[model samples]
Each structure stands twice: as C-alpha cells, then as structure tokens.
Target: MSDEPLRIVHCFRSPVGGIFRHVRDLAEAQTSAGHLVGIVCDSSTGGVHEDRLFEAIAPFLALGVTRTPMQRHIGFGDLAAARRTLGILHRMKADVLHGHGAKGGVYARLFGTSMRLGGRRVARLYSPHGGSLHYDPRTMTGRMFFALERMMERFGDGVLFVSDHERRTFINKIGEPRGRTTLVYNGLRDEEFVPVEAMQDAADFLYIGMMRDLKGPDLFIDALADTSRTTRLPVSAAMVGAGDDLPRYREQVRLLGLSDHVRFFDPMPARDAFRLARHVVVPSRAEAMPYIVLEALAATKPMIASMVGGIPEIFDEWRHGLVRPTVEQIAQKMREALDDPIQFAGLMPPAESLRARFSAGVMATAIERTYREALRRHS
Candidate 1:
C-alpha cells in the first residue's frame, strides 16, 4: 500500500449513461492528480451501444475492464454477476470502492462490509444518482426502495448525493443519519463544452438523451404537435440518442405524421449535438443532476425542462429558463419564452454564473478533498 498510488475502483453495472460520464470525468481528474484509477463494468455484446464510453476514457488511465455476465433483469444472472464482481474486488485490492446507482451501490457496500469484517481497511462510498429514491413514495416500488435504503445504510461509510434536493429527499424518506451524507453536484469540464453562439436561424428544439419512457421523448413530440396546431411558427424537433423505445417512438411520430416536423438523429458527441440546437429540453420524469442540463448550461443555451428532481435547483422559474410540471406546461413555457425577449436576456447572466460553478477544476478539487477525507478516515 505504501508504494502504490491510491488504488480506486469505480463499479457500475454499465459504462454508459450520465453516471458513466461522471465516473469518466472523475477518473481523468484523478489520473491527472496522480492517482491510479480503474473501472469495472459489464461486457459489451454485439449491437450493444455505449462502446463510445469506454473509447472515451481508455487512453487516460490504467483501466481494468471486467465484463460481468449479467442480464439487467432481476434474476439469477444478476446474482451470479454480483458474485463475479466481489471476486474482482478481491483481486483488485482496491483501497476505495466507489459505486454508482442501485446495483453498483449494493454490490460495493456488501463487498466493503465483508472486507471490513475480515480486518481489511477498505473505504466505501455510494452515489445513488437518483435510483430508488427518485420514485414517488405513493407506489409499492418506492416503498421497497425505501426499505432497501434502510438495509444498505449501515454498510456505507459515506453517501454522496448529486443535488441538495436528492439529499433532502433521502433524509425525509429514510430517516438516515444526515452527517454521513454529502452533496456533491455533478461537474463537467467547461473547456470541452464549446459555447454555440445563439443561432438566429436554427429552426428546431433539440432533445438529447436516451429515448426511454421516463425521459419523456414522447411528451416532447406531443408538445411540439400541440404547439404546431396553436401557432403558425414552423416548429421542428430533433431527438438524438437511441434506446429500446426508439422504434416505438418512431412509430408514434409517423402515426402523428410528424416525420418532417420531428426528426431523430443518431447520437453524436455531446458537443457536436449541442452545437446543432437553439434551445435544449430535459423532460425527464425524474433525474438527480442530468449532465445534459449541465452541458446545456455550460454551452450557455437557454433551456426548458420538467420541474422534477434537481432541475428546479439548477434553474429558477424566470432566471435561467422555465421549469414546468407537465408537457402542456412545457409547451406554454416555450411559447412564452419565444415571445419574451427581455426574459430571455435576463437569463444569460445567471446561466453564465451557474456554468462556472460546475466547471471541471472546481469539481475535481471537491472530489479530491472527499477522497482525501475518506482515506484519512480509513487510516
């Protein structure tokens, strides 16, 4: 241990999505700061996307790619994969195990707890990234998630919530001890996010993210459809990012005869995708801190998003952009946003200020401090 750099392992079920992006950013930051970083994730099957994620980070550090044979569904395969992950942890001799999301968090906690019981000094950190806690408490799954949180709380040395709202929700629902939880806003390298000059001629609203049910891609289409009916403005919408629901969403667009008005593009590098749009929309049913919103804010693009999760914390009603409750509300906000030049201008200063707060340097420093603290605690 004395001769080695801090051996850090980031465990995630898949090396994709916003959580994966966060992990990549941290790994690069840690490597630059002179720490050894490694990642373990599921193997890529043919036709499986997210290969770009591995490609993006491989050149930066010593990455250990372990492919877990696990189906995403809740069954025997997942348990077998968890066992495989535990074996990997034992082999890696990781000093700190940082887990992202539900499956990763559970596996890391169990592994760390077992190691601690055996007199091994391994610290554990869990970043939920808005998993079970993101659901409304009225449902059965939400209740089960609450119970799971209680079960897992004892195993974690520290819990990091991406937003204050997420932390507050966790405290409110689970009654977990507040002292162990910390709020670490997701950060991105602002240098990578080149700002697009507000396009005076760009015609469509842009939505970039997986086209999953919770992301509300359909709602964006529906809102665009309604907006077209009410206004004479030739509004068009472009969606980038493919998912299991992409074909079904394509059918919905065709059934609405909106093939021309609504277009779907293959997911491109985030910077390239952001350059092609005028306004960004995040209509997710739930989120913790979406990197898309941070990227949009960093790009200084005006946005309209759902008033859920950490979104309201990111943007005030009349400050950065509008945050609405429903699709119709989002459409109403869009119409209002288009009509009000003064309000849009008012948003720029605050947006720019917000962008600086999430810069990579700031985030790296915060995370480094957290890592040091965790190490000190273990010592």
Candidate 2:
C-alpha cells in the first residue's frame, strides 16, 4: 500500500438504485482504510432518503460532493455538463476517478484522459452495474449505445464488472475491451450476516428496490394480486423505495384495486426495511449483482428474486432460489413462500459462506489494488 491515502472520486448519474448502494459501501470501506473520497452525481434524481445518506457519509467525502444537473442521454447539452464535471474533478485532483454507471463511466474515463494529457496523475476506472447492458443489441438504440461504449473503453484505465455475467455481456455486446477488466462481486458488512426476523406485523411480501419498470415493481404488484387470488387469502405487501416512476406505480396499484393490500414508503435503510416483511421480493428484469441480494442473503432473510443478471450467480448451485420475471412465475413463488416460507428459506446459501465470499473488507482491498495497478499505468 502507498504511504498516503489515495484521493478517490466516484461519478454516477442518478443517486438511486444499485449503483448508489454500491458506491456507499465502497466509500465507507475506503474511508475506514484511510482514503479520501468524494461523490459527483445527479442532483435531481434522489429524494429526502438519499439526502440523509449523504449526510451520514459526509465525513468520508474529504474532497467534497458535486451534484449537478445530469441528463440521462447523450445530447448537445452534455458537452456543457461534461465541462462542468471536468471542472469539479480537476479541482479535486483525484488520484482515481471511478465511475459507477454509464453516464458516470463516460465522465470518469473522458475526464481522466484529459487529465493524463495535461500531465496530471489520475487513474480512470469504471464499474458497469448493468446500466447499459440492459439494451437489446438488435435495436437501433442498442447499436448506438454499444458503439458509444466501444469508444468509451479507449479512455478507461481499468474496467470493473460486478459479476461474471456482466463481463460476458459486455464482451458480447461491446466487443473485447482493450483495457484490463476485473470481476468483483458486490459485498456486505459483517453485521449484515446476522439473521433478520420479521416484525410481528410484517407484511406478506416486500419489494425494496427502485420503484421503476426495470426493477419490475409493476410485476411485483401483479404477482401480489395473483397470489391473493390463487391462495384465497388476503395478502399484504410493503413497497419500500422511491424513484421517478413511483407515482406511476402508485397509479398502477390504484387501477389494480390493490391500494389496501399494498402500502408504499420512501426509501429507508435496508436493514430496517428487512424487518417490515417476512420475505423480500427482488423481481428485477435486469441487474448486475444487486447489493440488495447480498444484503438480504447476509441477513439470512428468505427471498424470492427474478432470475436475471447476477442473482443466479449468488445462489451458486442452489439456483432453485430464482424465479422468472413474469407475473405468473413470480406468483408461483409467492404462493410457495406463503405456504411454507421455512422450506423455501432452506434454499438460501449459508450465512458463513455468504459472509466469506461477500465481505466489504475484501471488496475494498481488491478494488484498491486495481486502482494501484491503474495508477502505475497512468502514462
């Protein structure tokens, strides 16, 4: 390890979703290891919950935070935004610029490239947490994004993938990256490994991710209705997250006449939310090793998750834990969990194994090593 702590800056688009969680864990780990860290992300995306998270993590961000109006798509206006982002990064003089999602990755690699050209010492690293990989390459939009991904790779010093599935998808969609690539699964803190028993009035099901289509919140609501009908029992669900599409999902619940059965809340700490329901439901259509999976597993909470992204990888040989993303498939699992959550819970990996494989300490050390490698090659 170097004598001094490295200055690290993380850039991403929305301050929500899996990307945001991943950065929070990584930032805490890095800070505890005596590193200086900062965050640069979109100001308008997250809400009051995220504001509290920023407050809790403020001490770690010695280089300070930069929240700007960042757009989702690449457009003429992005040129100005890029300049603004570059200005923030330049002022920080970050030793490593690590980007979390597509927009953040683009900014990090491009800005780091400019810093290198100016004889500045910096390393550019990217972790694609299934941001751009959800695109269907057969479509025109996919082609455009994949092409942009290829160009972005040229600017990257080291490419990090959260799962083997994400890495394979990147190679298939964007071609083999010329830069170094590494696989680092998401991790959890030791305290998270303890089992979490539900509260006395825990809901029958819980959906605790971003309230958006990509995460399949709509499917969760549909399956809850289906489960109630099939089982002939009134089932309740707690949807504990916030996103731009939350209003739309609320309308969906209203139209489906599930207002009484399904209750909504803004985002809260994952551990606290875990106690609100008997079983967690992660019905995402796409993912790249979601931290929620790791969190739930570490907490020894029984779960029903969709078989997308790196979720299957988490189960390892116990792939029976996965269900399809469709309403029918999720409903099937929901019924089973309702009937016998104890048996269903047996399918989860042991806490010891999960703790061994997905420790935050291990993840931070491995990522810091990658940063050092990138800095060494920063010519």
Candidate 3:
C-alpha cells in the first residue's frame, strides 16, 4: 500500500443524526492526516443547524461537498439519483469510496464497481450504521432488505460495523458477509471529555435526540408522567430535538397534563442540552453505537439508557444496569435517578476506560488502516 495521501469520499443519505456525526469526525481526522476528503449526502433533510455543521467542515473538505435529493425509502427515483451521484463521485476520482447507511452502501459498492471498469483503482467500503439491519427478518420488509444486503455483499471490498451487536445482527439476518468485515466503535473527541456542569436551574431530566417514537421521545414523556404520578415528586424535563413526529410528542405531553412540567425546545448541542437538565435519558428502541451515550459519559453526566442494540457493549460490565425499552422500566429507572442522584451518577463508566476505547483519533487511525488494506486488496 502507498503511504502517500489519498482521496476519500464519504457518501450517505441523510445529513443528520449519528451517521452524520460519525462522518464529520472521520472527515476532520482524515483531513488533519493530510488526505483529501469529501461528503455527498441528501439535500432535503437537515436544517440551519446541519448547515452550520457543514459550514464548519467545508474549509477542510478538499474534494468538496455535494448534495442532491435522496428519498429515504427505495423507489424508482433511485435510478436518477444514483446516476447523478456516480457522476459526481467519478469526477472526484476517489481512492476510497466509503458509504454509510443502506442506500449509500448500494451506491458506493455498485457505483464504485462501475468506476473500476474505467481502469482506475478504487476501494469500496460500506458501514451499515444500523440502517436496514434495524428491520426484523421475520417481516416481509425485513426479508427484502436482508436479501438486498446479501446480494450487495459481493460488490464491496469491505464492510465495517460500528459495534459487535451490529455485526451479529448482520450475520443472523443476512448470513456471513462474503467480503472483509471489521468492527469499529463510534468515538468521541478529546475536548468532549471535559465535564459539563449543569445550569443553576437545570430540570430533573433531559431527553435529547430525534422526536420520533423509535427514539422513545414518547417513552421519555410517559416515564416522566409515571414518575410524577408514582412519586408525587415535582418532576420536570427538557425535551430537545426535531423530527416529523415532534408535534405528536407535544400533543401527547399536553394530553398527559405534562405541559407544565415538560417543556419542548428545538435541537441544540448535546452539552448545552445536558446543562438544561441534571440527568440525561437515552430511551432509544434501537441503536448502533450511538454517539450521544459516549458524549454523555465523557462529559461526566449521569444517564440511563435502554438495553438495546450496541448500548450494552458501551456499558460493558455496567450493562446489567441498563433498563429495557419500556415505559414501566424507564419510569422506574427515572424514579431511582430522581431519588438518589449520587447513586445514579455512580453508574457512569470510568472516563479513562471510555477514552481508551472510543477516541476519534483512534477511530480514524483504525479506519485509515482499513482503507489502505482495502485498496491493496482491490488492487
């Protein structure tokens, strides 16, 4: 493998959420390491916040940022989108085409293969990022997606999983990958390790993430209501984030008579949201090494999360303390957190252990090594 700088292009569907954060971290690290980096993602999704994030990283993206319309679900429109995306990528002449999520995976592997016919060397890599794998294999939708995953396995030089749980899901649903695979945990930056102090008037708890049901925003609301009802404690929360289901969650809050206690706010920085509340709650139904959990732990904030997806892996030995993704369980945990804040704080994983295993620099170095190996193998 050549030690010279290489062109790296990261392709993904949405310019929001964990996958976006992961790409941003990798892009920054790779650019700092003297490689040309670029991003191609859907234009329709993010708002001003995401635009600001793009602006911050725009200066370092040597290959430039490109965006176009991309539908979340598979449709006939994909043909045109794929053609346009392929043209953009081919023009970049990327040495490594790394895709995140399901649609991006298909585009990277299939389009990267097409680019190979043009007589240039290109390493195609795909990271599932808990995309289509979230679907159940027992359902027709799940069966179709898994079948697609099985078919696409042969096109890529490598498949990268963010967690062992994600890897296990792939094997169980689609069988073993025909191509190379590696597990790389999502990571945090050095500055993120500095603890965030709660504001003087912080609420009892914080619910920060997408407002969708899948992320359990409703569960957070229900848990708060239950905690207030069961304990008669003056429980309050700050719900931060935006999604299609945001209004629905607001209505649920109103109907449950939580309008006075639960205040909804637009999405903001996690650390900023952390300041709005004394404790953090990640009530996700599914995940693939969520960055929020790492950020919360690194900032020395006490948190309770659902025991689903790769969360247990993050918790490690503390995994036994994770609550199931249910209102009853979440409410119980919330009550415990409210009752003894110090005890809840004690459940946090040690900072040193998290830094060693989940640093952005380490993640970038390992991924860079994978890129080199994939390039050599493809060559």
> Which candidate gets the maximum TM-score versus the true structure?
3
Model 2 lDDT tens row, 201-246: 9998899998779999999999998888888888999999987899
Weakest lDDT window of 10 consecutive positions for candidate 2: 312-321
Give the Cα lDDT of each candidate: 0.75, 0.89, 0.91
Query: lDDT tens string, model 3, 174-207?
Result: 9988888888888899999999999998899999
Which of 1 and 3 is ahead in lDDT?
A: 3
| Candidate 3: worst-modelled 10 consecutive residues by lDDT | 313-322
- What is the per-residue lDDT of model 1 for residues 1-379, given as tens digits with 9 covering 90 to 100? 4434677888877666688789888888878877777887767431334676666667775646566764554577777788888889888877788888887888888998887777788878888898777667888878887888788888888888888888877888777653477677888775855676645555557888887878888888877777777776767777888778999999988887788777788877676776666777888888888888877776767788887788776664444465554778778766766677457645743555676667766776676666667767877
lDDT of 2 at 265: 81
Which of the two, 1 or 2, has more TM-score? 2
Top lDDT model: 3
Q: Is candidate 1 or candidate 3 better by TM-score?
A: 3
Predictions ranked by TM-score, top down? 3, 2, 1
> Among all windows of ten consecutive residues in candidate 1, which has the lowest summed lDDT?
44-53
- Residue pairs in steric clash, candidate 1? none
Better of 2 and 3 by TM-score: 3
